[model samples]
Target: MYYKEYGNTGMKVSAIGLGTMRYDEQDVKAGRFEKCAEIPLYALENGINYWDTAPFYCDDKSEIITGIALSQVKRSDVYVTSKTNFSTLGDHPSRDDFRRRLETSLDRLKTDYIDFYHMWCMLNLESWERHMEVLYSFFEEAEREGLIRNIVFSSHMQGDDIETVVETGKFKGMLIGYNALNHRFRQSGIEKAYENGMGVVVMNPLGGGMIPNHPEAFTYLTEGTDLTVPQAALRFVASHKEITVTLAGCTTKEHIDDAVKAVENLEEYSAQEIVKQFEGKGASLNNLCTGCGYCKGCPKEIEIPKYMDAYNQYIFTGKKKSILDRLDNHWDISKEKVLECIACRKCEEQCTQHLPIVERLKEIGEIS
Candidate 1:
């Protein structure tokens, strides 16, 4: 129920935004998007006013499911955010192509206009420049045409580079990956965005389910508090004055309730205090893969995210059986696929966390 100003844009967004990327896999695979659609509807009814989706999220059904939910609500009641990624838009997208993409998103979201449209998945200055050269003016045109209210971007780059992006003064907002494990790494960019009067939304607030899945590994974040580890993680991002929203990739109604509950009573904590609290914990988590799936496009056709997620199980429990169980039951990736990684390091190059992915694959391949 808590809301904050989205910068000086005169829009107040929910402190806990609903992210549509983590809808139930079975529902998506079985073409039961109506079941997936209900979660966003439930979230909107329950006080979440911000809904973020994209074309490819949830097996390319997120925007459709989001559209289904938005249809039942008054359009002005919620702020809708979607993205246009370079991977999808291609290297030389024309203005007409950009307009087409926007119109397609409008159709999928069941809205005539988007509240916020992002320069999705920006990785470095090179990519930022490329987008600016090829598509920034088109984004400006869309804003002027009332197709989108704000032009924003999402990034996984470090703070300094992101600060440079903010300095361009081209965006109205930004969504970045920030959590207890990596906030320090991206804090400067967040502060820069705030200083530039740009709205800052924190994605991957639960470290892409890492913090909740391994609560014991992050007890320091909740020590001396009545909050659960997930609650603590949510609070850590929401408590920041610079942050406009902390997005939780909620799949169930309970997840929505839990996310809403986590921010009900936010305490003002100093950034340094949070940093100091998590000072020594970096070694355990800085290298942890968040399952963001940016590491796709493997030349060998390996499902890198699945193996990295399985590796996470091994990291937590130190049991080969744990990794095997995750690959078999949850991911459906076989050990043979794990062994297929040819050390091309292509995935590692694209990885947001720059994890030792090939080495991890080697270790997984040697298992049993």
Candidate 2:
């Protein structure tokens, strides 16, 4: 229940926030509402006041469950965060689409105003700029009309986007994909956000469950620490000076309990020690692909990074079928696209993170 100042907003948020992404599982054959409702309620009773959810998660069912669970708690005692998928905010989203989506979200959540509203899944500079205009306008109107209290965005973009957004000085918070496996923010983006007075909220603090004790991807820290895989991962993110809260999307009460225990006994570790812990054991971000598909426009029409991303997701999250299913559904990519990497070294040159793209792609094709 430790609290931290949420940026300069003067609001003290819990160091551990509740993430609702796991509430609605498409794979579950049974109903989830009864069990899902308890996770938030238990979290709230234990002092976790920050709740993060999104419309894209489980097709908005996560938000609906979140709202229902939070209804039992006083609104003033909790902060609810939800996001809109900006990919749908097309060149010109129709008034109906915009209004319908917003209204639907509010209704589903059963809340008059959301504590924080974000533009979700922002990946590139072009998408960021295009959606910023729409998002700022929407938030401005919502604030004036009392529909939302704060503005924010969640990004999987690089340092440049982080700098641009923070410099705007409009958003109250920024959710970044950060964890032991993905430390891009710590390199510079996180510092930039802090410099511009923006609150940093960390998503995927477990590298999408990769920080846990997976036989293939387990880091040295996982083997040496007294903490469990999840504990080490959560603690690593929570220990960061820049992060206000580390969000964990818990599916079961057991998941919630483990996370709560980790945060309750959370220790402050030096950055050097944390870095040393993950020095080896296949946890480095050296050859990782984020599945962003930014390198897909190559003349060769290769599905370069996505395959690697899927492989990582499978190994880390233990959601092999789910990742494969997503790739199978979303992209009309061919087997050749997945298997025909020539190692021309073209993709390696274009990667922003300077990852060994060709090698990773080859590994992915072989592994998945």
Separate clash counts for every candidate: 0, 0
Total clashes for model 2: 0
Model 1, span 1-368: residue lDDT tens? 88889987999998899999999999989989889999988998878899999988888999999999898899999999999966778778888888888899999998999999999988878888898889888999989989999999999888999999999999999999999877878899998999899999999988887888778887777777788999888988998888999999988899998888888867655566667766776444667789888898998999888888898887778798898899889988788887777788888778888789999898888888
Error of 2 at 269 (Å): 6.4
Residue 280, model 2, lDDT: 60
TM-score of each: 0.88, 0.78
Clashes by residue pair, model 1: none
| True lDDT of residue 30, candidate 1 | 95
Candidate 1 lDDT (Cα, whole model)? 0.87
For residues 1-368, write the lDDT of model 2, one tens digit per residue: 77888887888898889988777475323556656778889888878889998876655577778878878788888888887755555567754666677777788778888888887766667777877666667667877787888888887767666787778888888888787666743436777777677778988777654445353454454464576777767877887767788898887777777777766655655445566655565445634555434465656677666565555555456665545664677554443465666677766554544466676556556545
